[model samples]
Target: MSEKIKIVLAEDEPSLALIIKESLETRNFEVIVTEDGDQAYNAYISEKPELLVLDVMMPKKDGFTVAEQIRKQDKRIPIIFLTAKSQTQDVVDGFKHGGNDYLKKPFSMEELIVRIHALLNRVENNQGSDDGLTHIGGYIFDYAKQSLTYDGNTEVLTYREAEVLKHLYSTKNEMVTRSHILKEIWGDDDFFNGRSLDVFITKLRKKLDKDKNVQIINSRGYGYKLIC
Candidate 1:
């Protein structure tokens, strides 16, 4: 029998937290719910869950802070930020602080389940090479570590960033359509996800800039090409 997937859910509201925990438990997931950011962080350290669902607003450290701390220890864990705020900057900040996905609050259980499955499947299927390292131009992309090293300087990447880079590297020199990447990584090719993809591409360019020969070029109406 397969082991049950474990998840750490950090939400402050007692009613909402209980509902989420019960819903996930019904689906056979091992859910560990924490009421605040500090407890959430501690739960994460002890539980070592497969995924994390963090509410953006909480007592003590907030979801972003918890995510930041966790990223320092484990770069590849999938983190989904839950927020009531729909501000563009808030969304951007979530991604900036190591979030792989975002789910606005007042969400449906089905939607949450789908996001959880998409993240887990992506991580499971993309655990590249035994050593978890790939070479591109003069840089080394460490898949497991979620980092890129150039000239001995390593730039640690967020989980989503590593996944995006890995996808580009797999089909280097070929035109990979934006829709394909969005569907493959984000599980959707909608406008919001498209914008998020653009953000990740921009971040990748800066990290890979140390090597002059590497570039991620856009194809106007089509998609992007990784020119290495």
Candidate 2:
């Protein structure tokens, strides 16, 4: 099954926040909640959730400011605004404030579900296959869902493992030096970092063990290569 859609919700109303949160969770959506606009922005910056739901009137910065800050850096991620204000001016301001969709308060959970699914479907339809699953031996990867399947007994890869695999694929037919992998991914090449890389290489090797022709060649004291 695909991973649950991750949502970051920022609402100041405790009761309403709980209701929305429970509704989302009940639908198997992973949600991160914050009561203030600033906290919401911070969570988004760090987590990079799939979607955002912000309340219009929030503590610390207000929904408009929060949405504006996020849009400044990322224009692709979908955003929705939730509010009690339903006037024409408020609706106009909400869009002007950078929300992809606006939901007036006293909305039903079912409506929220419909809106969330609509946005998710739009994003998915436009998104091409994930870069992570394009090639590996003769098997294709499913990056968004993190699975490797052929005949049966599919294996799931962790986020870090998927990232490492993607980077290695990008360097296919060329040696990816340990130094570069360290700096590019871990941003460190200390003793422990080297050990960590070794561990990752071991795990990746195990995953590709089924295919004998494909190889991740170790360059000994220098780098690694993804050989086809």
Candidate 3:
């Protein structure tokens, strides 16, 4: 049998942490639960988990600090932030600190499970491939490197941006529904996540705008189509 995927989860709430640990264990994931940010970081370094799920408000260092510290050495280990802070700036700060996804507090365990699977699947697929490269217009996208190169310019992409681009590229010239993209990437299609998706789409449009042939067309209320 394949080895179970390891996870480091940091949540200060005892009851919530226990519930999450039990749920993940039932799913055959090896979960390391910590109640403080300091212990969480230590566990992360020692366990070297396949994924990280951290609560924004934790004792002794907070999720942002932990994520920043981790990102300094590893940019590819998917980190998901869990917090009650839903402000736009807070979400942006989470991304700035190297978080791959964010889940607001009072979130469903099922949603968390789906997000975990989606992120792990993305990372595994890229690692399993011999060459994680894709061509779009005049640009070369390296999935493993999370970068886009064209001409003499190379732009590094955030984890969420890379996942969005990957999905668009895979469905090039075809309409990919917004709901599908949201569920696959953010694990939800709620108003906030939908708005977040729009922000990411705009960022991607600016990044690929140098090539006229590479266009991400919006299909009104339906979805988006990447024409390359």
Count clashes in each candidate, considering only residues at least 3 apart in sequence or on different chains. 0, 0, 0
Q: Candidate 2 on 88-178: residue-level lDDT in tens?
A: 5665466555565668789999988887777677567647645344767776776665566655668876534655677788799899899
- Per-prediction TM-score: 0.91, 0.55, 0.84
Q: Please report, as a residue range, the 10-residue window in candidate 1 with the lowest summed lDDT.
A: 123-132
RMSD of each: 1.9, 16.7, 2.7
Candidate 3 deviant stretches above 4 angstroms: 1-4
Q: Which ten residues in a row have the lowest lDDT in candidate 3?
A: 123-132
| lDDT for 151 (candidate 2) | 53
Task: Give the distance in Å from residue 101's predicted Cα in candidate 2 to where it truly belongs.
Answer: 0.6
Model 2: runs farther than 4 Å from truth?
Answer: 128-228
**Candidate that would win on TM-score:** 1
- The TM-score of predicted model 2 comes to 0.55
Compare the candidates by lDDT and give the number of the best one: 1
> Candidate 1: which stretches are off by over 4 Å?
128-130
Which pairs clash in the backbone of model 2?
none
